[model samples]
Target: MAEARSFLQRNRIHRALSRSNLLLGGDRELVLLTALAAAILIFVVLTVYSALLGISIWIGILGALRWMAKADPLMRQVYTRHINYRHHYAPTSSPWRRP
Candidate 1:
């Protein structure tokens, strides 16, 4: 009789690695960058109008990012990889053939 095996079952680490890492309902790095930029603008400018503008910009960016994330969590990575490929690639029959 063949022995049963659960050895290939997914574990906690696998789940963690597979999940999308989101921040403020959006991509982590992009949200952080937007926060940093907004903070800099708000503080460095030191004006009521500038502060309002900064907050507005930050809110707009966050809203847009959140909307995008809701649409697709892995869109950023997908788009980055997508841009590297051509619209169509011809098949190569042999290793020696020039691509």
Candidate 2:
């Protein structure tokens, strides 16, 4: 029993350390700011949600922000495809004709 518990605890710690490392390896400032915003939003949702409409709007905004962050890679992929297509398919004609 004790051995199993120790293994679980170690696994959790390892996972957390790996996640932290991954975040730190990227844009650390953006990660930290997003984390701060998420924490604040959670606190507000827990303590300040008196009306349904306002709470729903705040939650929607938070969801949209999260979606945008996750969608960045997809956006980059689309942009890359656009550039590749332009390079491969652009017209070869010269604007200045030879005399």
Candidate 3:
């Protein structure tokens, strides 16, 4: 059973690596969008059953925004602009700062 499990894990990793290579070799924008979508999907799915419905809903909303950004250039531009501005304006303090 352990051997079989290891084999399955290896196969999954191989397939994921191959798919990642294909995505990386193609259009960079598509790869970024795909990665964002996958991350949001995983977050929602993982949190759906936990006592974190609010967090899951927030992630789902962001995922919807990401999807819309993919369809609308203006949305993408606004989203990135705000993100850059936030990072620029925020102070870079110590890593272990308490609230």
Strongest candidate by TM-score: 1
All candidates in order of lDDT, best leading = 1, 3, 2
Off by over 4 Å in 1: 1-17, 86-99
Candidates in order have lDDT scores of 0.89, 0.52, 0.54
Residue 29 in candidate 2, Cα distance off native in Å: 0.4
Estimate, for each residue in 46-99, the C-alpha lDDT of model 1 and write its tens digit: 999989999999999999999999999999888987777756555678768986
C-alpha TM-score for every candidate: 0.68, 0.25, 0.25
Name the TM-score of candidate 3. 0.25
Lowest-scoring 10 consecutive residues by lDDT in candidate 2? 19-28
In model 2, the number of clashes is 0
lDDT of 3 by residue, 1-99 (tens): 555544343333565544322223333464466556656766667765532654465456556655664565355456778888985554648656765
TM-score of 1: 0.68
The local distance difference test score of model 1 is 0.89
Write candidate 2's Cα lDDT for 53-92 as tens digits.
4556545655654565455624434666898888665364
